[model samples]
Target: MKHTLYKHIQEGKTTGKKSFAVLVDPDKVNEATTEQLVSLALDAKVDYFFVGGSLVISHNLDECIRQIKVSCSVPVVIFPGSHSQISRYADAILYLSLISGRNPELLIGQHVISAPTIKKSGLEVMPTGYMVIDGGAPTTVSYISNTAPLPADKADIAMCTAMAGEMLGMKLIFMDAGSGAKNPVSIAMIEKVSSHIEVPLIVGGGITNPEKAYLNCRSGADIVVVGNAIEKDASLIRELSDAIHSVPVRV
Candidate 1:
């Protein structure tokens, strides 16, 4: 693995720079919209393109990734929902383990099944500890994984889970509130978890506006991912990216 994408992330963390990733749910966007999003991203100089979703039933993953690669040089990372979500067209894969939930499948079971294939695919495998925090509603991830999210207000739990993930050798820590979250992950939660972890912290879900995206970065999120918001309004991409990049590099 070249570790190109991971190196970019690591450098950002080391330099206190913030990144903005556009989460593209293949099931939601068609070819035309994807082109539009890629064009906007190219103009915005977006940091990364996260392609996947909890329930991507449309079978558009490969083409979606191919389209992004064709349109821009930005790295495309597969945010797989399951073992079946692998694709050779992507630049990297977030090998996620659901540390926040007790589900064996998400934690290790699916990884076991996907490991060999992932290894052969040549996608830079980023071992990510994925935490699902309560987003003030029942999310598809909670239902599909059959696991409950950590309580929204429980910063202690979030912090400990992230620390455990880092200790367990996770290359990155991602805390998501799930798609279309009623409330984004609290700034307090991001602060507590990021302060304790050495790895880069990624925060996503329900971040709709530039202010919220910027706040998430200021609070310690190395990467702020936005999907549902962009699905509704692609124009928000530039503004959101600007907001995140506007955060002063931490000293």
Candidate 2:
């Protein structure tokens, strides 16, 4: 399967319909919890499940993915924080490059060591440019990646980075306001970056409510991801889904 998720994104782009994805951090939630979330997610009609964390201290990933697949119909893609997070059962993996960071390790070093194994996993690989925008907190992704996020006000820099990612043949561009961010990526930043990139733009991190999600879509984010907020209240899944699907404004 050559990452059908990308095709779904493209179709959304062509149709001007927004997409919603739920990010599940294995280290934060358990199997039982995951199963419950699956039911909620199904009802919410989420487009995808992103599994992984900056530091995957949990061993339940394989079981978690298996359980989620059995109950959920949406594609489960691995949003790996480390190469070890790969699960063969996943529909695909985001082959990420931290384009906003200057660290060689994240830029290509890690990919070098994990390439051979990934090629054999039979998992669809989607090359993604990952950018961490200042989310008002120093989150684990920033700490672990050993890179500082671009200032939220620097729309020009974010735009250039995203454009660079597209020029380098990336299939998608992901802008994350680090987990538990007090503030989500600014709408201006989203607009600046999205307007400059042809590939799908996924905005996540600190999206606490439907209003924020709606504004993001209006700002040109093709896909909006909700994670931390949903964990606090599973019911937000349905509301978020409605917000993303009910309003399909193209910016």
Q: Point to the candidate with the largest lDDT.
A: 1
Looking at model 2, residue 71 earns an lDDT score of: 83
Tens-digit lDDT string for candidate 2 (118-229): 8998899999999999999999999999999999999999999999999998999999997899999999999999888889999999999999999999889988988899
Clash-forming residue pairs, model 2: none
TM-score of 1: 0.98
Taking the tens digit of each residue's C-alpha lDDT, what string does model 1 give over 160-182? 99999999999999999999999
Each candidate's root-mean-square deviation in Å? 0.8, 1.4
Choose the strongest candidate by TM-score: 1
